[model samples]
Target chain A: MRVGLVGAGVMGRVHAAGWAAAGAELVAVFSRDEDRARELAGQYGARVVGSYADLLREVDVVDICVPTHLHHDMALEAFSQRRHVVCEKPIALTEAEGREMIAAAERAGVRFFVAMVLRFFPQYRLARELVAQGRIGQVGVIRLKRVSYTPNKPGDNWYLDHARSGGMIVDLMVHDFDFACWLAGDVTRVYARAAGDRYALATLRFANGAMALVEGGWANPPGVFRTAIDVAGTKGVIEWSSDATATIRTFLRQPEGAAGEVGLPLSPLAEDPYTTQIKHAYEAIRTGAEFAVTPEDALRALRVALAAKESARTGRSVTLQGG
Target chain B: MTLRIGIMSAAHVHADGYAELLKQIPDVDFIGFSDEDAQRGQAFAGAHGVRWFRRHEDLLAQQPHGVIVCSENRGHMELVQMAAAAGAHVLCEKPIEVSRERAEAMRDACAARGVKFMTAFPMRFDPSVREVCARVRAGELGQILAVNGINHSENPSGHRAWFADPHLAGGGAVMDHTVHLADLLRWFFQAEVETVYAEVGNPFAQGTLSVDTAGLIQVTLSNGVFASIDCSWSRPAGYPRWGHLQMEIIGERGTLVLDAFAQALTVYAKGGARWPEWVQWGSDPNRAMIEHFLHCIRTGEEPEVTWRDGFEAMRVALAAYESSDQGTVVRLSP
Candidate 1:
């Protein structure tokens, strides 16, 4: 399968390596910066497409890795060319734009997948499976933390702009928002607060009566990336943290038949999470199988994230119209 | 000169620990204790080998120089009034009163009687917190941008019944836990909270935990520094310790992160009962706080944590509850 990559930046490099691991051909590369496009294309031995439109016509699937604000237009154009599209989260800045892109993908009858990479990570996937299997029994509360250093790029970094990136809640915390929904079902309401552009905290109430607390920050010193998740249920609790010696720990209420405070072993999957996500997308498109992270799923996560930003701005809880 | 101190009530969870610390103060006499519950008072008094006064007035008859008011939330005002009327300085346990009005009245009554009134905010006495506050004030971190704090403890209802009563404790985690960090942040920023927005939940024990056991309070200070405090009672029964106090202060130039009780030895109990416990080996903040209280009384100077500080911090904490109730930001008088 041939693939075309857009935006030869950090995410683009990650997708390039993913495509290589997935055994797909990197047929073309496109970036506004000709030098960046040429550099990435030279490493992959692919053509450096002059424009987004040219890249669209060159490959069976187009991976959109551009800035957040450009995602809508690029995905729509990709669907117009009847090409399968893998767009990075979030799908778009606004729900309306995201809806339009989804409609376009449906009209073109082409596969559309959102790169919600957390779903591909072994820990998060295992967490979702545990919840589904009722291993913990009726999850009551979930706490997720994703904090890292603020991104400092030399040029105009669109991430720093609230208008383009939707601030930290949308840009940084959409991962947890998506994961929360995947684990706890639909979010009914969200109340959030932010400290400048550095940190954002939110509480999500699910339709199933479960609650989730999300803490995402960019205020920490550079090179610090910390992620932790704690889910407490009726009979047990599951916890994971990047800083811990154990990858995951589970505590059961009744320990007679259970190993209390059992630590889950690490995933033996040698490939990176990004590679897993790309490989799944390739398999889904080739065999006409459903993508693990659907476009509608991405749209729902975006809706919650946008609502969190609104709640932070107005200091009011935002209630979603529908689950 | 040696200072004499009496315990007004033995109902507070920290009362016994305070009494133990009081016994260790070399120049201070741990006079005696009184409680509304006679049996509880006698039990505590017997445990410490001090007299258990049947009435608060009888305890005051001893003419102690100061008293630690470790009563229930509503009980604080009456105890402070009695201690002040008896010509004794009062070191009141947190949340001076359920409401700001009562707290102010207590403050005024103490002032009218010429007695020192101190609120117990031991985090201020924690050496690590003190160092951070000192460095932040010295411009080591530049203009302060934001502050984040967490005061997490085991479900207090498991330990104390009054803590779960809204009337007796004001509120749950928001009331019982928010004050200490609020006092500390007010001290660090040297400002009062201008606006508060909060959310509270009882995810662990929805039908059982009577009041909110998990809460998040976000505030904007008069100094333009935004802060968030997580006053959650989410610690499990068999956790390492009761809880912890952690703060991260960010500034224009740099940042300072602090864990008040991080200096500890982790002990795994035999047979894995109370599997892991953090035995604190750090400098005792409670001792330092008691010492400061007595020092202020001896010098006839104001205490480090005053009644007004307690009143102001309570205002912020109460504002958090109001915000959570109304589902909107609650503004406070600057």
Candidate 2:
């Protein structure tokens, strides 16, 4: 499959690697900053396009790897051109936008896949399967946490702005929100409290009578990243933590005068979740199989995240329609 | 003079452990126990080979120097009142009573009788917890930013059915699990909880149980510190140990992650065990707490964990329920 990637940012680079691992032909790359686009395109032997419109026309599938606020417009344009799209998590900034994106894809008769990559991670996927099989019996409570240093420094990044990135809850915790719903069911209610833009704690009541505590933070020390999930069921409990699963440890001294950028923790998996997600998308597109995360599923996850954000703002619990 | 300590009731699951710990304490005379339930009381007495007083008053009639009230949540006030009126110091199990009015009355009763009243918060005596508290107090971690506490356990209804009974236990996991962390937060930060927001549910026994089996509580302290507690009876019957308490404290300078019950050896037995068990070899916090209770009684000093501590923690737990019910933040009056 021919793929065109937009936005030569951190996620764009990651998605490029994913597409490469999936053996997709990275035909083009586009970014507002031409140098970054050229640098990324040069790595994958892909050409740099001057505009998003030019990039969309060049490939059968357009991967939207831009900032969250840009996802709706870019995906809509891609679907208008009858090109399949792979968008990053959250689908869109608002539920309305997500719904519109889904509708546009249906209207164009093309596939729309959202990278809710947690569903591709082996641990989360296995946990979901276990819960579905009743290995842990009826679901009861789930606790999930993802904490790391702020994506970029506070003043220098769009992620710090709630308007652009939806802050920590919408951008980071949304993964766990989707996972919780995937593991249990639809969330009926959301209650959340956030401290600044750094940390947030949300409690979701699922339609199946299960409760989940979803915590996300940008408050960890530099170079530290942690993620954990604990699910309690009627018959047993299943738990996993990033701290407990590390098979490699490195302690190297920093070079003099080097920029102290935060490092992402690598899992050292034979095939990372991003690659798995991209491969799944490729296979589904090829065979007309259902995408692991449908547009509607992405919208549901967004609704829960938006509700949590609203709850945090109002200091009240927000209830979803039809649970 | 040896400190004489009597057990008020054995209706609580901790009663057996407390009884054994009391017998092991030095210079303390353990004066048997009493229970309102005749069968349970007799069974406990027979198992421990101690005198069984059929009535709480009968136990108080022993005129012990101090009494440990290990009754069910609803029975705490009655037993404490009896012990206080009998001029004996009281070390009562957590959630002093089912309601604020009763808890306050119990406190007044003890205060009026000039007998010391201590809340049984064993985590305060836990060595690891103490070291962390000391470090935080010493400004080792700098100014506190946030805290995350987890107290998870198997549903107590498996062994003590009253724990799931709303009337007997006051509430479910929220009532049973929230106090230790509530008290500990106050002790660590020396701040009062100004607001509480919680989402509670009975996922474990949704159709059968009338009380909540799990709660996720968020609180804002007076010092501007925010914290969350995942308090639940979500563990299954086959879980290795009864439960665990863990905390993550975020401070300005650094962060501290504490697993209070992580000091355990993994044991895989050859019997019909389906899961590996965690055998804890750490210092017994209950023993330390009981020793502190005896020391306070002997020295005629006020207990470290006071009636106010228990009252405040219960207040937080009750506010959690109110917040869950109303779907809004419940603010406490300072």
Candidate 3:
């Protein structure tokens, strides 16, 4: 598969590295930074395109790692060129924008995806596997939390400004919000609250009478970071982490007697989300297999994050706008 | 050798169950219970066929080797102080007290008096919940992704206004229902709550527990599993005295969902018009807890419920209240 990468940012470099290692053809890399773009492109054995339009000329997959504000317009251009678009987080700031991009991609008959990287995380993949196997009888509830130091670099970091980044709510939380809906069911209603525009809390009631709570923040003092999640059900509980140093644990309550612990640790892979996400994308492009993170899934997540922001601003719970 | 135990404060609802269980244990002596209210003292004593006294001091005068402080939440600190002063070991119920400061006092008093102090957290003894913890530690569930706990009951405030008042209950359903779930989650995963996001309501709390009938608790555990819970005392009555609890611990190889107390086979009388077993089907949770307490006391080992366990549970509950106050998430110090 020939890949053209846009936006010579950290994320773009990540994708370039992924394509190089996977034997996928990296046809070109595009950026406003001609020197940096060519330098990074050469590392992947690909040429640098001076303009975004030049890269779209012949690539099969044009990954858009540009700023959120630019996603809507750039994605349309790539879609019209008949190239699959892999956009970065926030997908476009709002579900409406995501829809526009999705509609364009559909009209062009090209695949589209939002990089919700958890779907590619090995521990998360294993969670879906356990659910598939009925290891925990019918998941009844899910609770997720993602926390890290609040970025002080307001203008440069991009996550500090609420307008540009949507703060933690959209940029950080949309990932899991989409995940909860993907696993549980359609989220019907949401009650949320925010503090200092940094930390956010939202409770979602799924159509299945199940509930999910999401806590997203970069407001804590500097540290490595902490991500924790738990799902409760009829049989037992499944708990896991994003940190590679930790292993997953299932608290099973059946099959012969009393409650007990079952340690399940996945084999560590050097290739994390960056490599795996693209692998899934290429896999999807070839076989039409789902990229794990679909446009609809990404849109649902964006809706949840946007709703939380709206709810926080209004001090009222918001309803999930169904598409 | 028989372990002579003194019962302090018969005001707590679960006190009678502990009295009955102690009598059944051949190794335990069913010593008299003390109640500030003599009516409660006699009622508890007569109902369980145990002895009683009007004052906790008089009860401690018996010089029993151990004491069970089953009193009002406010009285926990005082009763624990008395028991420790008398050089008697102590076992108290959840919350330890209404505040962390008071709970710490009780712990410090117990330690200074060189007495065994345990808080009765019976959910730890349930076979189903423990199984989940076992499998998690054994690495069968793989690297965890998330954890959740559900605890619901008829409102805690309706029956007792003190359960709703901040000075008495400390918080609403957030305090009443949170400890058990927090302790259970912490024990099962061996994780601490790092941050909390909560939405508290006062719906069913009518007279006592307040209108905050339901609450959603969002938290992150130290082990890096994002966790949350829907805890409340807002279920419809006649449905069941107890609501329910379910948990999902998501992992690498598989997920573990634990539905503790999912089923209870109730016997129906022929041509029954009402639940005839209201008299017969009393609480078994209390019985299970007391039995485990005796098991630990006799074996000189830690019971499933320890005082430190109660402290951590209280911390989680307090954090939830803090989250509730601001209507946002609050992170706890490591």
Fnat values, one per model, are: 0.21, 0.58, 0.05
lDDT of 1 by residue, B1-334 (tens): 8888999888888888998988888998888888768778778878888778878999999999999999888889988988899999999999889987788889888989999999999988988988998999999878887776778677777877889888898888888889888898899878888888777766666777678877777788888787778787766677778877988787766457788888999898797646677888999998999999989988988888988898888998889888877867899986
Candidate 2: tens digits of C-alpha lDDT, residues A1-323: 79999988777888899999888999999988788899999999999998888888899999998778989999999999999999987788998899999999999999999988888888899999998999999888899988877775323477777777877788888889989999888998898877766677888988777888888887776667889999999888999998898888768886643323333445888998888899999889978998988888888888999998898888778999975
lDDT of 3 by residue, A52-79 (tens): 8888896989888866778888999998
User: How does candidate 3 score on lDDT?
Assistant: 0.71
List the candidates' TM-scores in order: 0.90, 0.96, 0.57
TM-score of chain B of 1: 0.97
User: Which residue runs does candidate 1 get wrong by more than 4 Å?
Assistant: A126-143, A154-156, A161-163, A191-196, A203-213, A230-269, A312-317, B271-273
Compared with the true structure, model 1 gives a TM-score of 0.90
Compared with the true structure, what per-residue lDDT tens digits does model 3 show for residues B34-55? 8878766777778988777888
C-alpha lDDT score of every prediction, in listed order: 0.83, 0.88, 0.71
lDDT of 2 by residue, B261-331 (tens): 99999888878343689989999999999999988988888889999999999999999999988977899
Clashing pairs in 1: none
Candidate 2: where are CA atoms >4 Å away?
A153-156, A251-265, B272-274
Ranking according to TM-score, highest score first: 2, 1, 3
DockQ of each: 0.27, 0.61, 0.05
Q: Determine which window of 10 residues in candidate 2 chain B has minimal summed lDDT.
A: B267-276
- Writing each residue's lDDT as its tens digit, candidate 1 over A1-323 gives 79999988778888999999889999999998788889999999999988888888889999999889999988988888899999988889999999999899899999999999888888888888998898777776677878776766447677788777777789779999999999888998888877767777787878886777788877665545667787766555677877674445455355342321111112446887889999999999999998898988998999999998888887778989887
Which order, best to worst by DockQ?
2, 1, 3
